[model samples]
Target: MKLIGIILLFVTSMQAQNFELRVQAKTVIPGKKIYLEYITDLGKVIKIDSAVPSAQHTVNFKGQVKDQGAFYLLNFFDTPKPQKVLVILEGGEFIDIVADGVNDEDGKGNFTMKGDYPNVKYMLELMAISKEMETKVRKWNQEIQLDQKQEKRIQAEFTQAQTASTAKIKALIPQMGSHLVALWATNFLPAEKEMTSLVEIADRLGKARPAHPQVRQFVANLQRLQGVNEGALAPEINLATPEGPTLALSSLRGKYVLIDFWASWCGPCRRENPNVVKTYAAYKDKGFEIFGVSLDQNREAWLKAIESDKLVWKHVSDLQYWNSAGAQAYQVNSIPQTFLVDPAGRIIAKGLRGTALDQYLAKLFESK
Candidate 1:
C-alpha cells in the first residue's frame, strides 16, 4: 500500500494537468447537444468536445489541457448563447463543473466548479484585488487632475498603495506553490524593483514546473526584456503605414527614435499626445524622430487621432487592436509605452512620459 501511494504521487507530480468536466444540464430541452470549450492564453476560444447528456442531465468531458488554469464554456445547442465557466486545468485531480443554467440577476451562467478548487479561487481573488487597486488608481488620477495642489500627497498615496499591492502579491507567491499563479506573478513583479523575487520565482518554477508552458513563457519573456533593455539594439518593427507605404523602423537608424506604442481609444495615450508633440517639436531638427505604432483596429479613428494631435511623425500598424502583431513583437502589455532609441538604433531609455520626455532629450543634446 505504501509503495503504491509513492508510485501514485510520483506519477501525478510528473504529469501535466488534465481536465475532467462532469457537467450538469438537466434544464435543457430533450435531445439537445452540448459542447465543451476552453480558451487559449492568446484569447482564442476552442471547442474541446461535444456530447448529448445521458438522460441523467450529466455530460462528462475528459481531456489533456494545455494550460494549468483556463476558462471553459458550455455551449448548449438549445440555448441562444453559450455559458462560460472558469475551470482548473492544473492536472492530477478531478475538476467537477456545475452548469446550473444562466443566472437571472447577472444574466451570466451560474457555472461553477469544484475539485482542485484552490487555484480557481486564487484566480478570482487575484482579479478582485487587481481591480480594487486599479479603482483606487483611477480615483486618485481624477482627484489629482481636479486638485493639483494635492498632487504630491495623492502621488505618495498612490505609491504606497502600489507598494502594498506588490507586497501582498509577493506574500502570496510561496503559498501558491508551483501553481500557474506563481509563474504568472513573474510578470507582475515590479520589473527591476522586485528583481530578487522574480529571479527566485523563475528559478523555483524552472525546478518545479520546467515542462509547464507558463514557466517556459516566463523564461522567454525575461529574455525578451533583456533584449529590449537599454544598450540593446532596438528590435526591428517594419509594418505598413496608414498610407500603403512600408514604414520600417530600421529606416530611422542613425537618429534618436521614440517607438511610441499607443491606441486611438486609449485615454492615457490621448492625454500624453500633447507632451509627445512638444518633445517632437523641440528635438525633431536634432535627428530626433517619433515612430508611432498604434494598437488601433479602426483605421479612420487612428488617422483622426494623428491629425487631431498633429503627430507629424512616422506611424505604422497592422491595426489588429490589442492583438496587433507589431505590438506583440515589442511585447507591449499596455498602451503609452515608449522605447527611446539612440542614433545607432540601440535602446537608450524606456517608459518616459510628459516633461520627462523633453528633459531626457534636452539632456542628451546638452551633454554633447
Candidate 2:
C-alpha cells in the first residue's frame, strides 16, 4: 500500500510540470531576453515567461498563424488548469533557450515556427518586410511634417503622403497580407466601401492560412461590420430607456429615424443639437423620429444634458464610454456621428451636419 501511494504521488508531480504555450516571439535577440504578450476580449494583457531559456523549450498552445500578420498564441499552462498566458510579438523570431532541464535536457523543444520544421528561412523574410514597411512609413511621415510647416504646400504634400502610404501598403499587401489585413480590419479600414475590400482580403488570407486564429477573427469582425453598413438592414438595438422600458431600433421602423451618436462632453454634438431639434420639430408630424445614443460614462450627466438641451427624444445607452455596445455595433471611433435610416430601416446617409442634415431632410420630404 505504501509503494502504491508513492507511485500515485510521482504521477501527480509529473502532471503538474506541464506548461503549454502558443508563443509568438515579439522581440527575440538569440541569446537575450524576449518580450511576449497577448490580448483578450476584456482588453486585458496576459504576460507569460520573460526568462532567457538556455535552450528551446516546449511551448504548447492551441492557436493559429496567418501569413504576414501579427500572430497570437492561446497559452494553456497545465492541462485542466485555468491559468492563461499571452505572448505578444515585438519583432523577429528565433529564441535562444538557456539550459533548463525542467522539460528537456537538450535545450530544444517543439514550438510553432513561421515555416515547417528544419527550415525557418521565411521568418527572416518576414523580418525584412516588417523593417522595410517601418522605414517607408517613417520617411513618409517626415515629408508630411515638412509639408505641415508650409501651409501653401500642405494640401499637396498631404495628398502625396496619403498616395505614397496607400501605395506602399498595397505593394506590401501580398507579402504582409495577413498583418495588413489584421491592422486594416482592426483599426484602419473606414466605415465605407473600404470595408468590403478589407473583408475580401481577410477572406482570401483566411483560406490560405486556415490554421491562423487572427485571420479567422479578422474575417468574423469584417462580416459583422459589413452587415451594419449602409443599405443593409440596421441591426436591432434594444436597450434601457428613461421611461423604465426597453426601446428597440426595429420598433422605429416605418419612420425616418436619425440615430444620433453623441456624448454629453462632445462640444460639436452639443452645438449641433439645436439644428437637430429644429429638424425634429419640423418633421415630427411627418413620420420622423430621432434616437439619441449617448457615449457617456456618467449616466447623470447624460440625462442632465438631454434635459438641458431639450432633447425630447428616445435616449438609450449602456454607459460604457468608448466601449459602448452601440459604438461597437455601429463601428464608431469618433463622436458626433449620425445615421439617417429610411422608413425601411436602412441607412441612407451618415455624418450629416447643419446644412447637410437639412438638405437630406428636405429631399426626403420632397420625395414623399
Candidate 3:
C-alpha cells in the first residue's frame, strides 16, 4: 500500500534484527528532523525511522529491520540545503556513516562508511562511475542533435564509454563477495548486451539471497524477457475501438503487423506519425498493416490524432491514460514504441522508428 507516515513497512517479513545507524551532520539544525526511508517492492517510498539530533551534531538510529537486502535512504531537508545519501542495507548490518553536510558543487558528497561495508562501498563506487558515464552520454546525445553529420563519431564515443563502464562493473562482480550488489549493479549496463551475465548473476543470487528484492526483481525481469523474446508470440491485446467495438491484436494475424503504441499527448509519437504513415502507404498493399493502440484519456483527442496524422490503420483505445489494457499487455514504458510481427504472429523486430522503419519495410517488400 501507499505510505504517508514514518511507520511505513514493506515485504518479506523475517526475524527482526537490530540495525544501528550512526550519522554525523554538522549542517542539520538542532530542532529539525532527519528521515530514514526505505523503498518497497511496489516502488513506494516509506519512512521507517526518523531522528532529531542532540548536542553532538549527530543522529543515531536504532531500529529493527524486517527485510533483508533492501535499499535505504537517509533524507535531510532540515539544513539550508537538502541532502540525501543511499546505502545498500541489510537486516543485521550496523552502518556507521559520516556526513559533513557540505557536498561539492553538484550536491554529491563524499560519504564514507566506517567499518567493513563492502557491498555498500562497491555500490557507491559503481554509482559514481555510472553518473560520469551518463554525463558523457548526455553530451553525445546533445551533439548528435545539433550535428547529425558527426553522429557516427559522437555515437562511437558513447558506445566506447558504455563498454568501458560495463567492463569495469563486470570486474567488480566477483569481488563484491555477494551477488546482491552485483544483481543491482546490472541496472547500469544495457540489458540486451548483459543478458548472459544477468542470468548468471540471478541464478547465483537466487540460491543465496532469495529474500532480496533485487534478486526477486531480477527473476521477474528475466521472465518478462523470455516472454517478449524476438520470436515469442506477441502478447494478446484486446481493447475497445473508438466506436465501441472490441479489437483484438490476434485478429491481424496473417499479415506483417506493426503493433504501434502511442498517445495523442505524446509529442514524439506525433512527430513520428508521418514516418509510420509513409511506411504504411508504401507497404499497405503488400500484406502489411498497423494496429494502433492509444493510451489516451479522451476519445476525441485519440480520434483527432488518427485523422490529423491521416493514419489509415486500425485504431483502438480504452480511454485510459497509461493504464490502458493494450499498453499493459505489451509492457510499453514509453510512447512511440513499436513491434513488428510476422504473418504467424511472432515478433520479428522491435523499436523500428523513422528511417529505420522505412529501411525495414523496403527490405521486407523487396525480398518477394
**TM-score of each model, in listed order:** 0.68, 0.48, 0.62
Winner on lDDT between 2 and 3 is 3
- The alpha-carbon lDDT assigned to residue 168 of candidate 2 equals 49
Off by over 4 Å in 3: 1-17, 24-32, 52-58, 76-84, 91-115, 211-214, 237-345, 350-368
Q: What's model 2's lDDT at 218?
A: 55
Q: Please report the TM-score between candidate 2 and the true structure.
A: 0.48
**Candidate 2: tens digits of C-alpha lDDT, residues 199-295:** 6677777777666555565566666766676787777777777665878898998999999889997755776687789888988988899988888
| Candidate No. with top TM-score | 1
What candidate 2 gets wrong by more than 4 Å, as runs, is 1-39, 42-177, 180-188, 200-215, 229-231, 264-282, 304-310, 321-337, 350-355
Candidate 1 scores a C-alpha RMSD against the true structure in Å of 6.2
Candidate 3 residue lDDT tens string, 241-344: 87788998899988999999899877658866876888888899999999999988878889988899998899989887766777666645466778899999
Against the reference, the lDDT scores of all candidates come to 0.74, 0.59, 0.75
What would the per-residue lDDT of candidate 1 be over residues 74-152, giving only the tens digit for each residue? Answer: 6765364445555546665576666764444434455555664667666556656776786886787788679878866
Q: Could you tell me which residue pairs clash in candidate 1? A: 17-91, 18-91
Q: Comparing candidate 1 with candidate 3, which one achieves the higher TM-score?
A: 1
